[model samples]
Target: MNKYKLYSSTDFLNDDSFVEWLLKSDHDAEMFWDTFVEEHPEKKNEIEEAVEIYNHFKFTSEDLTLEEVFAIWNNVKHKSVEKRFSFLTVLKYAAVFVLVFTTGALSYYLYNNATEETEFTIAENKPLNFNEAQIILSDGKSVPLNSKESEIKYDATGEQVIIDNDTIRQAKKEAEPTINRVVIPYGKSSQVTLSDGTQVWLNAGSQLVYPSVFKERQREVLLIGEAYFNVAHNAKVPFVVRTEHADIEVLGTSFDVLAYPDDKMFQTILVTGSVSIETKSKGLLSGKNKMVLEPNQMFYLDKESGVNYVNNVDVATYTSWKEGMFDCDKLDLSRVVRRLERYYNKQIHIKDPLIGTYKISGKLDLKGDISEVLDVIQSFVPIDWGKQQNGDYFIVKPY
Candidate 1:
């Protein structure tokens, strides 16, 4: 199947067809599994190990209540035909167990196992590049923001004010809500506070279009690129973030959204509270569907395939960019470089494409010079860089 390949052990373990075959001996699933087994017999060991992992973390082991366990088992019994039960079938049921529970919301959650020893293909292209940060105030006056420290703050009375030291930035005449747009260019970041007390850390190359004050029942904002938001809780008012790829609705949550338009994917990582994400992609059975995310879970939507997958991740790894640090655990070199390109507003071409497959662990501070970061990277990996006449960088295997 063009749609099928090994994303990770977690992918297959949480696959629908695989789970169907496990629980119900579904006809199509049986065919796929039979063909898969015939083709890649070597992965049988891995498949078995994934099954063991599922069983170990079953509802009984997790925080699921006894009623949940009993309800799921009842469904399992109905799914299983009157035919004799096999040990393999039982294993399948356990391996794909996470799919059984779905939130009542119109969203879907695809979970992953984090323990796979797999090298994933990473996107390296960066096309949403820009040069400067700006604030478009209500009077149509554009105030330039510096890369060092650019910030904005507004209040419920619809007042706008810039927060860079030694700067005179103010807005007057606010009897109603007014839209304010803040654009943060690549190589820089910013911070903003909405009138509702919601705080947002705008990442490099991001644009946030928000209202100067909250109105009525909802607080909505439009985002491009990436941002981390700690929404102020108001039970009567909901906070929503709209991206090109998805719409995230929340009551109150701390979450990070990475929706760089040029990248091959859109990603969201939930740090705390809950969120319901609605994709513009129309659904088959539901007409339109949404995907709900729990804390510490990350979702990546492949732009080309329109297929999104979720996995467990260290929340800090994705959210740390706002803190001027890049935290990764065995992340692909190409992906790391892509992020650096955005943060530095520089282009880096890897002379040896194979080096992109290399993975690095740990964290690096992004507040330093680009050359300094490269030096640290080279110290860890056998790589070096040369600057081109055009000011772009070329990374190569050191002499």
Candidate 2:
């Protein structure tokens, strides 16, 4: 007997087999659904609607509560063209529920009871622990690069990837555009040239998710941690960088974005050209919540206190990391050490709280060893460091 013969969109959403097929986890489930869809063409609309919801929500039956189910049903009922319907109407109208699902674009959907906009989380389930930098292809294949600093270049067609000396050819399907991801763990960095000629320098402990080829309408990429972008000039198709808190839009601009998930503040520094930062509370197309930044201007947002402001500053203070150096303009010692920890993949603790408040100024050549870098920092501040038994370093008052 075909159990899914009379199944509605809601029933399919509640079924585990359907979810497995949607996630492409079970081959048998995929075959079953394919054959069932062919045999039961009447349910094609229902399955399409359910797939849209599943892709946008990424929720399973357990994630949805009874009240939430009722809400979905009520939403469908209210939007249905037929004012009157039976109890078994199903959730076919959910496809028209004003959800956002663009191919190869950063997701901006509703969540936490489907009330507000939910940003795309970079590494919600997976931890960043790869020793080597890697590129995760759309087909779930991971290509690892074993260099301290890797260079990646995508051809104009986005069908070929050149990683250092090796070249990889990837087949593209027009129906399903590919979205590639680059993950640079601690102690490593990567420079990627997108298909559109945009250049991006990804810092350590950072990840960037971008499409293999940009769509005609726009070019957008999702960023976590820090990156410096020299975007290509394409006024017809604006380039956008999306972080957890804000989306930076620019036609062709050079900027630095520091948006580490663990960091309390999200910052954007415009080195050249102009860009607009839009928070999640406001729509991207709307100008009400957009903060425009001119060259040499910076936009800062404190994720914890919900406070944000703009300041004019030297662009080198924020962008020198990509040039194999760190430029400090009276930056805090604690902030400097944090970057060192990520760049060296080592743990360092400040035993005294007051030491963290010490301001440091100057430039640091990051190509040297951690000990050498610490020595340079020591020259700027009165601090001494000792190694613990576990290989971790601790900062204390000078002996």
Candidate 3:
């Protein structure tokens, strides 16, 4: 049996001060509480009681005198003795008893204070920072669709490319023009709505080099990182996404590509429609090596061996981020932290290596508060997190 620590009334009072520190400081106090509860289950009841008192104090401006505070403490002590519950009593009962009394006092205060104005101000809105990729023309000039710009018509091609409100728009033209190579920097993502109205969502630290317009023969795009594509159907013009090791050709489909340069494998998950992937380096373009995928199928290419494998998976798990949710299906801690880093734009350091291997499966709404999301994750994982000097989080596997 694990030896549990018992928190006395004094300890409960000290915890009130800790709650104040938790709210004022930038650290993730809820994560701390989660780990603390796991380690000291015996004190969980006392800690919850302290939390109720702290919250009650926070909502009221009337400060209790030291004498009044002592009196209240004595009242609580007397009730504990009168109840004469066993020391091994369940934590939930104690928490409920403490909360009931605290809530009674809070209700009385709120009812008597008629002049106290309680207005809720909406929290400050933080706009989503989208990463964008740009196409740098062959000339010294660059076409930056992610930046604000006025519409300009190309004198040579007569094709209209509008850069406004930090978005790039390409108007359909009679003739498709050739485009030069472009690079996408890290921490940025850009979208290209194809001539057929297909949308592509690019991930951060990735690049796609393509022409200004596609030719009649074939529409080809070079991918370096991760991107999601809703390909336009044109039997005459096949849509081909080319990476370093393999090429994915599709007639009309929606799929996600994960081919980060540093990663060991390139993954292509088909959400809808069908796609054929071919490997040029392995000289395995033969029917035996070529892999075809249907909806809900994922194809992975090993970087070292140039071998491809296909598996069935849940399509929503890969596409959830586009819909403003974090969906993880048995994902390891490292992968979870990686997605969090991108979403929050913060660096994370895991103090314990073993923690990275812990698998997690859940879907968290990105539209909610970050702390709420963190609290939900803490409920499932055995770890503690706190803010670092640079406003990032330091995650540690608790003993």
lDDT of each: 0.72, 0.79, 0.61
Instruction: Tell me the lDDT of candidate 1.
Output: 0.72
Residue 324 lDDT, candidate 2, scale 0-100: 87
TM-score for each model: 0.65, 0.68, 0.57
Q: Which parts of model 1 are misplaced by more than 4 Å?
A: 1-130, 165-177, 282-287
lDDT tens readout by residue for model 2, 1-399: 288888899899999878766755456877778888899999999999998887786332222332254345444534454565553544345553323111112222223222433332221122223566888776656788789899999999999999997999888876655778898999899999999999999999998888788767758788889999999999898888877778898999899999988888899999999999986542222222579999999999886545789999999999999988999999889999999999988999999999999999999999999999988888889999888999998899897
Give me the displacement of residue 93 in model 2, in angstroms: 34
Residue pairs in collision within model 2:
none
Clashing pairs in 3: 131-189, 132-188, 132-189, 133-189, 133-190
lDDT of 1 by residue, 109-133 (tens): 1111234221111111221124668
lDDT of 3 at 46: 78
Sort the candidates on TM-score, descending order.
2, 1, 3
Candidate 3 residue-wise lDDT, 2-41, digit = tens: 2225565347566554545445533565566577788877
